[model samples]
Target: MKKILNDPKRFVDEMLEGLYAAHPGMLGYTGGDLRCLVRADAPVQGKVALATGGGSGHLPVFLGYVGRGMLDGCAIGDVFQSPSADQMLAVTRQIHGGKGVLYIYGNYGGDIMNFDMATEMASMEDIEVRTVLVKDDVASAPAERAETRRGVAGMVFAFKTAGAKADQGGSLDEVEAVAQRTLANTRTMGVALGPCILPTVGKPGFTLGEDEMELGMGIHGEPGVRRGKLETADQIAEQILATITADMPLNSGDRVAVMVNGLGATPLEELYILYRRVHQLLADQGVSIHRPFIGEFATSMEMPGASITLFKLDDELIPLLDHPAHTPFFRV
Candidate 1:
């Protein structure tokens, strides 16, 4: 309930206002609506455009990646809510640089519905659109039903690979292919220690005991696979890595990219501690760490938790992951 703001209803508006104000010429909006955010230098003619949208509160997520080598546009909604189809369509139109547009987002019902509606609407305007839903949360569903799982921090990998492909002059189909490929090779497992309060609601969506944690919890406080007493950092990392490696077995000679992401309230030091374990564990398996991303890549509005994402990599994806990308919150 404790947050710094003037009006509860104006939270998103004011946040976007400040974002635009702080990053002028680097970011902007469409149709005079701040909800439909796009790169300032949008419609880079003939380049396939990448767009994503989801609720707010997860900053640098649906909004932060809109930049030089990432998403071209995004349709933002309220905290943990989906944006309207109209808003999505506005972003699609504004960033459709003549080649086509690709929509990459998590596998959530509201988002799927609205993005599909936007796709249909864009078709009437002759804008070709392709959709790729990120289904990387291994804990959400069994391997056989992974297609039904929710997307998590792993979607960031998809964003990077897909965006790099598009910026490199790949066609719509090519970019979408890279996105799907990246997501298919990614797996994520999260543990939550506390819940985040919504700005308007002014209360935590869920709660955890002072000495407990929930393993494999969703970013939105959805039920996790296990709940029990809190464990040490190394223990948490091992547990998460066990599940991830089981799902996507890492071979002795395989190379991989790892990300230890904070769920908002966790500090940078803690993230690095988690990453250290991840790196050591992977090394023990003879897997080389091609790259490591440790930070608050995605969040739940001050939620206390962290997620580990393992992205099985090959020669093709390494370059894409290493590609220079610049956004307000992320750079590589």
Candidate 2:
């Protein structure tokens, strides 16, 4: 119950206000709706606009990725809640370019339902909309049904690929193809050590013992496959990497982009500790690491955990990934 805030009901509003204040030149809201944050230079004419929406708490996510070379607009809901279809539709109409719009978001039930409705609403106005759901969490479901699996940190890769394609004047179909290809080639797995407290709930979303950790946990405190005593950083990394690599089956000569993301509260030092083992393990397997990103790319408030995402890269994908991208939270 220990949190610093003036009012729980206004948490999301206050946070958005602070965000716009800090980056006025880069971001702004549409029609004064806190749920809709668009780039300062959005609605690029005659180009395909990329829009994504999801719940709050997972910062640097649904909102932070909105800017040049990334998302043109984002619709944000409350913590762990999906945005209303109307809200998503509003952002869609405001940012739709003459070409069309592409919706890239994680694989979640609420998001799927609302985005689908929004697509239909946009169709009435002759604005074409497509979607690419990121389903990379190996822990969410069996390999046979990975498409139904929950999306996790691997979403960041999808955003980069789609955004790069859009930035290069690619058509909506081209952007959709690249996003799907990236999603198909990516795999991720995560472990949780502690839970995050929701601002409104005024308590931890879940609880764990001091010496216990949960394997295969989802970002929103979803149940993991196993719970047991905590292990060393190397051990944890091995477990997660094994699941991801097994699902994807990377060869010795393969190249990949490695992302070791902290859920929220995990420190950079700990993430680097895990990354050290991750790099060594991949090297031992003869897999080459091309570009590595290690930090809080996606998170669940202040949860204590990390996830590993591997995107097997080809020539086209590698270059698109290397393309310059500038956002409020990610610059490369």
Give a tens-digit lDDT track for model 1, residues 1-332.
68889898999999999999999989999899999999999888989999999999998787999998899999999989999999999999999999999999999999999999999999999999999998899899998998899988999999999999999999888898999889889999999999999989998888899999999999899899999999999999999999998898899999999999999989999999998899889899899999899888989889999999999999899999999999998899
Pairs in clash, predicted candidate 2: none
Please, what is the whole-model Cα lDDT of each candidate in the order they appear? Answer: 0.93, 0.90
C-alpha TM-score for every candidate: 0.99, 0.98
Model 1 alpha-carbon miss at residue 244, Å:
0.7
lDDT per residue, candidate 2, 1-332, as tens digits?
77778899888888998998899999887866878888887788877899999999998887888888878999999989999998899899888879999999999999999999999999998999999998888999988887789988888888898899999999999999999999999988889999999899898877899999999999899998799999999999999888887888988989999999999989999999999999999999999999999999989888999999999999999988888899889987
In model 1, the runs with Cα more than 4 Å from the true position are none
lDDT of 1 at 40: 96
TM-score, candidate number 1: 0.99
Per-prediction CA RMSD (Å): 0.7, 0.9
